[model samples]
Target: MAMGMASSGRRRGNRTRRAAMAEINVTPLVDVMLVLLIIFMVTVTLPAVGVPIELPESRANPVEELPDQVNISVDNAGRIYLENDPVAPGGFADALATIRRNDGEQPVIVLRGDTGLDYGRVMAVMGELNRAGFKSISLVTDGSDTAP
Candidate 1:
């Protein structure tokens, strides 16, 4: 009879031990957090240029970035994209006008052209921008530490 009581007491103690083992495992949580950190770092480095274009390399110094800057990208197909949105060839001027009116200030234009794109295509876009009276135009290109 005493042995039976002692065994019941041991069963209660085992139940308490089982309850204590229900602690949250931090190892899996830490692994998930680390994975999220890596994902964020990879995504942040992507270019804000809107379109994926291979920019020509240049040794020229980079221009100062402006908060009110508009990115213009010309793809290899000669498609013009204003701030990542496709702008029709004929409506390019109207788009520029609308931006100026909405911003109430002259926004700096940063032009990015694909390396394989013809020079004439890039110049044509620049000419139109010039006609729009955008005095601040900056060309974006990939740059290296060592100048060629």
Candidate 2:
């Protein structure tokens, strides 16, 4: 009987038993979530789409930015905008006059003209600004990489 029990124990030893895993391993899942989070964060900081315009490059020194400055943009389609707000072509002068009176002080005007726009269009806007009594006017352009 002892010899038979020893043989049964050997047979049982020959068969392997494995315990089933009860807990989930979340390390890979957490790593994937973190990578997705980083991708979103990087994309969020990129510039959003706005009025499409190609700016001409110039070797002129960059003008100092001021808090009391206003932007007047002209798109390639000849549409005029005041700080992203569309202004009617005929109402452009009136709008500037109103803004000038409300501010009480002459603010610097920054004109951003698209490269495809007519030269006369930009000059007309500038003339209107001058008529509105704004003396400080600056033309915005992309900086040239070449050394002056």
Best by lDDT: 1
Candidate 1 local lDDT, residue 4: 54
Q: What is the C-alpha local distance difference test score of candidate 1?
A: 0.83
Give the per-residue lDDT of model 2 (tens digit) for 26-70.
Answer: 999999999999999987743221556688889899887776688
User: Candidate 2 has which clashing residue pairs, if any?
Assistant: none
Residue 75 miss distance in model 2 (angstroms): 0.7
Instruction: Tell me the deviation in Å of residue 67 in model 2.
Output: 1.4
Leading candidate by TM-score: 1
TM-scores for the candidates? 0.68, 0.62
lDDT of 2: 0.79
Cα-based lDDT at residue 9, candidate 1: 32
Backbone N/Cα/C clashes per model: 0, 0
Candidate 1: residue 55 lDDT (0-100) = 91
Please write out the lDDT profile of model 1 over residues 1-148, one tens digit for every residue: 3555433233553372223355788999999999999999987756776689999998898787766789999999999999989999788888877775335667789999999999899898999999988878899989877767
